[model samples]
Target: MRFNIRITVSLKEGMLDPEARAIQGALKNLGFETTALSTSRLFHISLEALDREQAETLGLQMCERLLANPIIHRYSVEVLQ
Candidate 1:
């Protein structure tokens, strides 16, 4: 079976996001007000799997092995159709 997955990676809480901060600053300069800002990365993956559970497991393994750093990054995996 073919599975589609969406993975979102982001910095852990208390981690500084320079890019988000910079963008928020820019927004402020443009007369926009923001209370907080954060950033994340989205990965869309297509692969073959035996079942939805297997697909989700693969997605998590991908995050653990390569996609995200356990110490500084957190990630979520969602299996789509």
Candidate 2:
């Protein structure tokens, strides 16, 4: 079977997000009020798997092994048809 997987990766709390901060600053300078901001990455992958459980397992392994830094980042995986 084929699966559409989405992995969302983000920095853990207490980690500084300079790019997000910069964007927020720019927005505020442009007259948009903002309190806090953070940045994340989304990866959309299409791959073959035997079943939904296998697809979800593969997605998590992908995140743990390569997509996310376990120490500094937290990630979530979704399997979509």
Stretches > 4 Å off in candidate 2 = none
Cα deviation at 26, candidate 2, in Å, is: 0.8
Off by more than 4 A, model 1: none
- Model 1, CA-based lDDT: 0.97
Worst 10 residues of 1 by lDDT: 12-21
The residue pairs in collision within model 2 are none
TM-score of 1: 0.95
- Predicted candidate 2 versus true structure: per-residue lDDT over 4-80, tens digit per residue: 99999999999988889899999999999888888899999999999989999999999989999999999998998
lDDT of 1 by residue, 1-81 (tens): 999999999999999889999999999999999999999999999999999999999999999999999999999999998
Q: Best candidate, lDDT-wise? A: 1
Clashing pairs in 1: none
Residue 7 in model 1: lDDT: 96
In candidate 2, position 79 carries an lDDT of 91
